[model samples]
Target: MVKYLVVFEKTETGYSAYVPDLPGCIATGKTKNMTEKHIIEAIQFHIEGLIEEKIKIPISKTEADTFVFALK
Candidate 1:
């Protein structure tokens, strides 16, 4: 299993999840469990895309991440 950093935030409607290693890999659901489930599917899809494209997926903390979340 690939381990990716998933940041989750609570909102009035639900939780939103994003992967730090993947740009635009974001998903949301009405609860943490649902958000995680969505993220799991997203991660698999994202990884497949990366692998297919032969792109390197970075696992490092990006400089953008420090200021990217007002939600998490």
Candidate 2:
């Protein structure tokens, strides 16, 4: 079970998500929870398609970190 880093962004109409390791794998929904669900499905479908095509599954190398800043 490989874990891929998924990035979520807020849009005017809804939330959008994409897997950095899996290019072209993306999903959008009305809410964060819904978008999460759709992204999960998208990742699974993407992997399955890669398997069917005999393409090499990419290893997760992307990482994320957050830092807090204070301003006067």
Cα distance off (Å), candidate 1, residue 29? 0.2
Candidate 2 weakest lDDT stretch, 10 residues: 1-10
lDDT (CA) for every model shown?
A: 0.85, 0.98
Candidate 2 lDDT over residue span 1-72, tens digit each: 899999999999999999999999999999999999999999999999999999999999999999999998
Clashing residue pairs, backbone N/CA/C < 3 A, model 2? none
| Residue 24 C-alpha lDDT in model 1 | 89
Deviation (Å) of 60 in candidate 2 = 0.1
**Candidate 1 colliding pairs:** none
What candidate 1 gets wrong by more than 4 Å, as runs, is 60-72
What digit string (tens of lDDT, one per residue) describes model 1 on residues 1-72? 446778999999999999877888999999999999999999889888988999986675644446455775
TM-score of each: 0.73, 0.96
| Model 2 CA deviation exceeding 4 Å by range | none
Give me candidate 2's TM-score against the actual structure.
0.96
